[model samples]
Target chain A: MEIVVCIKQVPDVPTVRMDRERMTIIREGVESVINPLDYIALEAALELRQKAGGHVCIITMGPVQSEVALREALAVGADQAILLTDPDFAGADTLATSHVLARAIQKIEPFPDLILCGMQTTDSDTGHVGPQIAEELGLPQVCGVNEIHREGKFLVVKRLSDGFVDTVKVTLPTLLTVTKGLCPVRDLPLGALEAAFSTKDVLEWNMTDLDLKKEEVGFAGSATQVRRLRTPPPRGSGDIIEGPPDVLVGHLLRRLEALSILDEEDEKK
Target chain B: MRLEPTMKQAVIRRSVRKFSERRLIAAAVEMDKTEQFPWDIAEEMAGLQYFGLEIPATYGGAGLDSVSTAIVIEEISKANAAMGLCISVHNGVAASPVYLFGNAEQHRRFLNPLAQGKKIGTFCLTEPNAGSDASALETNAIRDGGDYILNGNKVFVTNGGISGINLIFAKTRADGKDLGFSVFIVESEREGLEKGPIEDLMGMRGNPVCPLSLRDCRIPLENRLGDEGGGLKIALSTLGGGRLGIAAQALGIAQASLDASIKYAKERRQFGKAICDFGAIQDLLAEVGTRIEASRLLTHRACDLREKGKKYTMESAMAKVYASEIAVEATRVGVQIHGGYGYTKAYPIERFYRDAKVCEIYEGTSEIQRVVIARELLKG
Candidate 1:
C-alpha cells in the first residue's frame, strides 16, 4: 500500500486578492497554505497506510517556496516528501501539472500502489488535475470519495454523484480524489514541526530529473489560456416568499423552471 | 537584525492557531463556565508535545527553541488563556528548571514523565508570607537522617489540582541554622501532601489554582533539586525564562481581543453606519492594534535573546511588563469598541478582558518586572 498524495500550496483564500490590471491573482506577500481539501486527502492516505502498513509519500509541484507545504505534510506524518519545483514548471495548467505528477509517480521505485488527491483545489477549483493524472497514468480513479474501506487488495469507497450515493469497489493500484468527509485532518504535532522545517530531506525533482522537456511541462504545455479574467456579477436580491413548506416547494420549483435550471417534466415528477 | 518571524516560526504560529481555533476556543468557554479541567483536551495536547515544548526529544519532549516555544504559548493563550497558563507554567517554570539543573538520574526519573505529559508539573513557591519576597517563605526542609522532613503550605499553586509532580521551594535547615532556599521534587501522592480546594477566580477560571500543604512530608536526600542551597539561583533563573512565557501569553490575549474588536466594529452598526465607520471607534481599534503589535515585538525579542543563550533577564522583564500592560489595555479597548455588547458574555471580548489581567499579576506582577529591569540597569 505505498501511497502517493498530491498536494498544492495556494494563497490563503481570505487573504487572496485579484490583480485586476494583470487579470491574475496577486500571490506576492500573501500567506500560502496547503489546500484544505488536499489535507483531507493526505489524512486519508495516512489512515490507509496505518491500516495497511505502507509508506505514504507526499508530492507537490510549485516554486521553491512550495516546499513549505511539503514540509507541513511531512510534519503531519507523511513518511516522505518530494518537492517538484522548477522555473520550467511555472504557469502549468491542470493538464501539464498532471503530466509532471504522473511522470514523477512513474519514477518512484516499485511504483506507488495508490494515488490520492483532493477533489479540487481552493485556488483553481477546476477539479481536473486528479482525473487527468489518472488518465495519464492509465489507472482507474474514483472522484469525490467520502468514505473508504480496505479489504484484501480491494478498496470499497462511497461518493455522492448526481444526488445518488455510489459505492464502488476498485482493485489495487488505483487513484482517488477525496472529498471533505474522507477523514479528519489532525493538527500537526508541534514536536515534528521544527525538524520538518529544518531537515534537508525533502527530495527535489526538476525537469531534467523527471526527464521532462520545458515546452511540454510549463506554459507551453498548457492547452487553455485565459483570454480575460473578470469577477462574476453580483447576484441580485431574490424575492422573499412567506408561505408554508408545501407552498414554498411549489414556488421553488416554478422559479427553477423559469430560470431553466429544471425542465417542466422534472418539476412534474 | 531580522524582525520578521522565520519560516519555521511562522508555520508554528499558523499550526497552533488552527488547532486552537478549531479545538480550544469552544472548550475554553465550557471550561470557564464549568470550572473543570478538560483532561481529554489535555491528553490531546500532550500527544502533540505541548507539555514538553522545550524538552529535548531524547527525553520525550518537543525540544523547540525558545522563540518557537513562546509562539506556541501565545497561540494557545489566544484561544484559551487558562489552558495557555497550564502549558506555560508547566513548561517554563517547572519542567525547564528540572532540565536545567537536575542531573542524569533526576532527568530520567522526573523530567521524562513531565515532558511526556503523563505527569503534569507545577512550581510551588508562593506561600502566605512569600509573595513578592520569595526569601520570606516559611516552608522548612529539615535534615532528618537520610530523609528531609518538610513542613509548609504553598498557596495559589497553578495546576495544583492536576499536577503529579510539584517543584517545592523550601528553606533548608541543618544544625538549627538556615542553609538558604533549596528546591525539592515532591510528588503529589507523597504522605502528608494534601491538595486544597480549587479557588474561584475572575479570569483563567478553568485553571485549577489551589493551595498545597506538606505536613511533615518526608523525602529522600536525592529529591532535592540542584544543590542544598541553590534554590534561589534556580528560582531567579527559571522565573526570568518564565516571564517570557507570560509575555507570550499576554500577547496572545491582546491579539485575540484586537481581533474580536475589529470583527465587532465592522459588524455592529450604530447611527446608521457600522461602528467601524465612526472615527472614535477607529481610534480605539488603531491604538489597540498598534499596542498589540508592539507587544509581539517585545515578547519575540526576549524570546530571541533567550534562544540565542544571550542575557535576556532585563529584556524578558521589559517584555513581560509591557506585554501584560498592553494586554489589559487591549482588552479594555476591545470591550469599549463593542460598547454595551462587550460588557456581556455574548462576545468573547469580556473573557479576554478578564484573562488579560492575570497576565500582569502572575509569574511576576508588572511592578516586579519593572523592579527587575531597574535592578539590571543599575548594575555596575
Candidate 2:
C-alpha cells in the first residue's frame, strides 16, 4: 500500500491573530506547527503503513519554511517528504490549494493507493480542502474519521455523524480526512530529528514542476476572495454561582427558565 | 558566538516538552503518591529512546549530542523530577561508563539492552561508608580463576529496585594484594544479590531508592569494565558528565518552580488584589526567574563544552552547584509565593520543594563540586 498524507503548517496559537491588511493569518513572531488534526492524519497513515507494510509519503504546500514540518514528518517514520513550494502558489484558498494538491498527487509514480488529510486546519478551519481534493481527483473520501481498520485491500472507518456512529468500508484509492482518536502520535526518537535534518531528502516541487499555470494555482485560481478578516469580539464574563449542590441546581434552573432554555413547569418539577 | 539553540535542538526540546506534558505530568503525581515506578510509562519512553540519549545509534541508542541530551533530561525533569533522576543516573553514570570504557564485546552484550531500555541500569558507588569520598569503599571482589566473587552492600542506589544491570565498584583482591578499585557489570538476577526495601523519602518518592547487597555474587572476567584498577579514572570521568545531567535536571526543576510561581502569583489574590501586584511578590518572582535563566545558561554552557569535546570538568561542577542551589531556591520561592496553599499537597510547588533538595546532594554534593572547581582553578 502506498499512502500519501497532505499536511499544512499553521500557527501554534490557540486563537490565531489575523492580518487584516492581507486578509490572512499573522504568522510572524509565532511558532509554526503541523496542524493538530493533520498530525492525526499523519499518525493514521503511519499506523496503516505499519500494518500493511508500505511506503508513507507526506506532502504539504507552503513556503520554504514549511519544509520544517515535512522534515518533522520524515523524522517520525515517514518514508518521503514532498514540499510543494512556489512563490506563485501563495494566497491559495481551498479551491486552488486542493487543485494543486490533487495535481501533485496525480504526479506521484505508481499513483497513491490511499490519500489522507486532516479534516480541517487549526488556522483556516474551513474543512473544505480534503473534500475538494477528493472531488478534483475523482476519488471517494470520508471526512471526520476517528477510527480506521485495515481488512486486506479495503479500509473500514468509523466516525460519528449527527448522533450515530457510522462505520463505512471503502476500497483502495480512496481519500480520508482523519480527526483525533485515529491513533496516538508517538514521540520522535531522540536522534531522529538530527538524522533527518542531516541525511533525509525532502523533494521540492514548484508550480512549474507540477505543470500548474499561475492562473490555475495561487490567488488568481481561487473562487472565493477574503474581502475582510477580523477577530471576533471578546465574550462577556459569566456569573460564577457557588453554593451547595441543591442550591446551585435551583439557581441554574431559574436562570435557564428566565433565558427560555427551560420551561417554568419543568423547572418546578 | 551563538546562544540560541540550533534548529534541530529547538525541535527536540519542543518534541520532548510535548511528550513530557502530555504523558509524564499526570503520572508524576501518581508515581509520587504510590511510590511505584511506572513501568508502562517507561515502556512508552523506551520506544522513544529516552533510555539511550547519548548512546550511539549502532548500539540501538538515540545517539543524541550532549546539548540535546541535556534538553531532554531537563524537560522530563520539569514534568517529573523522579523519572528525571532515573534517566539522568541511568544514562549518565550506568550506561555511559560501559560505552566509554567497555570493550566491543561488552558493547554488544550490555550496551544493547541498556541503550534499548530493555534493562534499566544503575551506577552503585555510594556505600554506607563511602558517599562524597568515593575511595573509602569496603566492597571487595576476589579473583577465583575465571570469575570474581563480589561482596558489598551498596546503599542509596538510584533505580536499585528496578535496575536490571548494576555497575558495581569494588576493591579487587588477588593473593592478598589489593588492586585499588575496579568496576564489575553485575546483573540483578544473579545469585546472592538482594535488594532491600525501597526508601520512604520526602521528595522524589517515585524513584525506588533502595539498598543492594551482593554476597558471593560471582561475576565473569569479561564483566570487568576496563583494566583492573581503572575504576577511579572511569568514576571521575563518568561523574563529570553525570554532573551536567544533574545540572539539567536541576534546571528543569527550577524552571518548573518559576512557571508555577508565576502562574500562582497572577491568579492568587490577597488583600483585595492579585499577590503579583505587590512589590515584594514581584521581587521574589524576578529573583527566581533570573536565577533560573542563569542556571540554564550555565547548564547549557557545560553541555556545549562537553559536546565540543572540550574539557568541561570545572564547568560542569560549576553548573551542577549553581543549578542545584537555584533549584532549591526557586522551589522555596515557589512555595512562598503560593503561601498557605503551597504548604499543603494541593499544589505541585511543595513537591518541587522536596525534589529540588536532593539535586544538591546527589551525583556530587555542592561542597564537593566546589572542591572540584577549586582544584581545576588552581591547576589552571
Give the lowest summed-lDDT range of ten residues in model 2 chain A: A260-269
Per-model C-alpha lDDT, please? Answer: 0.91, 0.92
Which residue segments of model 2 deviate by more than 4 Å? A147-159, A164-172, A191-195, A219-223, A236-269
The CAPRI-style docking tier of model 1 reads medium
A167-221 in candidate 2: lDDT tens per residue? Answer: 9999889999998888888778876887887689999999889998999988999
lDDT of 2 by residue, B1-380 (tens): 56887767878889999999999999889988999899999998898899999998898888888988999999999999999999999999988999999999999989999999999999999999999998899999999998999998999999999999999999999989999999999999989899999999989999999999999999999999998988999998899899999999999999999999999989988899998999999999898888888888888888898888899999999999999999999999999999999999989999999999999999989999999999999995
TM-score of each: 0.94, 0.91
Name every residue pair that clashes in candidate 2.
none
Best by lDDT: 2
Residue B1, model 2, lDDT: 53
